[model samples]
Target: MRAGHCAPGWNVTSMKDIEHPIPVRIAYVGGGSLNWAPTLMADLAHDTRLDAEVRLYDLDPAAAERNARMGGRYAEVSNGTPARYRAVPSPREALEGADVVVVSILPGRFDDMAQDIGIPARYGIPQAVGDTVGPGGFVRAMRAIPMLAEIARAIGEHAPNAWVCNLTNPMSVLTGALHAAFPGIRAWGECHEVTKIRRQVAGIANADAGSDRWSFRDVEVNVLGINHFTFVDAISLGGRDMLPAYRAFAAANASGVNETVPGEDAEHDRYFGSKCLVKFDLYDRFGIPGAAGDRHLAEFLPVGDYLADPGRWGFGLTPVEYRTRDQARRRARAEALAAGEIAPVAKRSDEALIDQIVALAGGGTFVSNVNLPNRGQLAGIPEGAIVETNALFSGLGITPLVAGHLPEGLHDIIADHAARQSALLQAVMAGEGGALFPLFHEDPLVRHMPETEARRMFGEMIAATSAWLPENLKGAA
Candidate 1:
């Protein structure tokens, strides 16, 4: 099995002579040289049932090539799956014939984020936060929506059958844009957050990591509202109520190793510890931990609660800052690898749970946290509005679970947030700049401020994001 470009007419029938017959062609956009794509490819290649060919595209051709080489090396050393890699600067070229198009692009990356935060802070709006909340999320959505629309258009034109797995922030907005714009396209946003949360719960429950004790299988957890503002309405294990144990864990500050995640760093620290304040609050009131935390939680809480005191809660860096710092560190490390001063990060082979869903989709069983039309998935949400919940996938197709009526309190809060976010996505898709003001005004962090101040901060943040936002938004700013 050769690596790199493949000759034409290498049909599955001809390939069957070798061993594995059906090759799953995956196209990845952005973070091509990052760990996820290569690691995922390596895992897929090892499966005797999968013949995986990865076509990686990025704005930076060199980065794409580097990623492809590393991915090729991973396949060769590990499973010896006939893996082929390509670096196409053109998104259309990379997207052609892709069974799955994985999107992880950050349009302006972090430099633009710094401006979104710094400029707003200058106006005394005090936004150490960005990404999931505030004017920053609005601006970020504006910049990203167009690109995602373009990606969706490309998929529709070039590979109508491809499943788009979006791994971008503001996941709800982007996924909603795709759903609204290309109704025929099969797309869903992917986030590791829910999986991480499930693992945390298992740890809190003192379930063994090695067994099915805490496996996500058959565990019913309801996530509502937008991406980051989601809350767990119900969680049950083996038809037994588990919310009591989860609430106890949240309240008691139980310290147990999280069995699902594989690291112990600042990321893990924040994951396990930092969001306790909100979880504590939610448990006391709602009897369960809020699925979204930190900036996400701040965005959903009443504005008064968020604006009361940043000192006591401590403001944190925005998503752009966090992502930028991480990327810079990764680039610095990659530079060492390029100079042969450091060995390439050793590739690991762990099957992504998402990939399992994809495999199931191919085989006819599709289970995931999909962002798609409500169509009665949740009793209270608008029928066509996007809702994230457990979905059953089989050969027939994807079926989102209809979450029966939620608790009235939770339903009201989630419905409010969902309406705001859905409107934001619609505004972006329509390129309506004025709609941004309302979205910002609706945000929990800004709702408490006077109308004049809220508008002023919104204007200021838009100005800061001028460099990255769409031309219409720039003009509005």
Candidate 2:
């Protein structure tokens, strides 16, 4: 046999020969509908180490067919390797023998959520307030948790050894549900927030783009608390603390911070206007970079800030507005497709972080980030608490880094939040409502509500979500 090549039924000459030779079967749950699927499929097709078979599962048959067709096109265009593509509605059929499962489901659909927020706004509650901190996030979480649990259960039965990666909102909450309910399964939740923050920090530092001198390594990001609520406690460049520079940058541009990059007229500034001021304020007070953008950060604050005089918060739109805009864009794209004005689909450059992990695992190097517990990867968080941290992957398997003791204040906050998330997950898994009230109270934004209003909002929010919640949580007053 040639070096670096393994033949079937090899003679017992070396230790490597006895290792498994089966091609890793990777399945993507909810992969068909996402705009990012084509690029991801292309990446998977190009990776030579593993004999990759990409299976795409979605409830929508047309969408699934569209995704598979795109994947086939990419294989021919990129690698000349014809990869297998399967579209199946059954989770078991899609997940069977899979080494990795990527999930990105939009349960309740964007349209339903637009209505959820819009209908509530008509009743005087701000629509965006519901998604991040108030009724919206809670109800969205309620609707999503059950579906995630169902996926977990299906993965448990069909793909017992596969690693599951969740890319959904209320990330920590959903990951927590999988951790509590499916003990044996390996899973993690990922979002673009941390990566986005890193990019912003780089731009703030005025680093050269093509040089290896500046990268995510140059910055030390201390992201504590839940996904969107994370704050960058410290940032450093070239082994020197750079918080002062960041502060100065914010101050100098306070009047009209043009976050737009130079020489890029077409580039829309990702962070701009009043939200930049809010980001500055957060940096000043917390000494940490805000992970989410100004729009999301705005929602976490008191609704009165924006609603004080109705329409005073200039250019600031609620989550429903964001959703509405996204829906319109999606509709336009669909119409373009119908009219043959646009190509069947276009490949996205950005790939889900999970796909990278799977590729690395096929090789023998491990990388770690926030993932659910698989041993003692996280020290202080309870055995199964979903933690965000670095991880390592290799032929040996995935291992999360053991984040040592966190600050007492941060620990307490994380623990409290984790408890509520855990309880909610448990409630969904066992179909119990006992944990709902405690979960609501644990929310940081809910802490700001008056006791009377908190109770009222809690009841009303639960009532609104009752139709979609587990049977046990439904009809509960």
Could you tell me every candidate's TM-score relative to the true structure? 0.83, 0.77
Q: Candidate 1 lDDT (Cα, whole model)?
A: 0.62
Which candidate should be chosen as best, given TM-score against the real structure? Answer: 1
Task: Estimate the TM-score for candidate 2.
Answer: 0.77
Candidate 2 per-residue C-alpha lDDT over 384-463 given as tens digits, one digit per residue, 9 for 90 to 100: 65666544444556555443445555456556666666666676667666666666655665565565666666666666
Q: Which parts of model 2 are misplaced by more than 4 Å?
A: 1-24, 42-51, 79-83, 119-133, 207-222, 234-244, 255-274, 298-315, 318-325, 331-355, 358-360, 364-368, 371-383, 402-415, 447-465
What tens-digit string does per-residue lDDT give for candidate 1 at 358-424?
A: 4444532434456666777777887666677655544445656654665667778778767877888
The 10-residue segment of model 2 with minimum total lDDT is: 3-12
* Alpha-carbon deviation at 336 in model 1, angstroms: 5.4
Q: After superposition, how far is residue 119 of candidate 2 from its true place, in Å?
A: 5.4
TM-score, prediction 1: 0.83
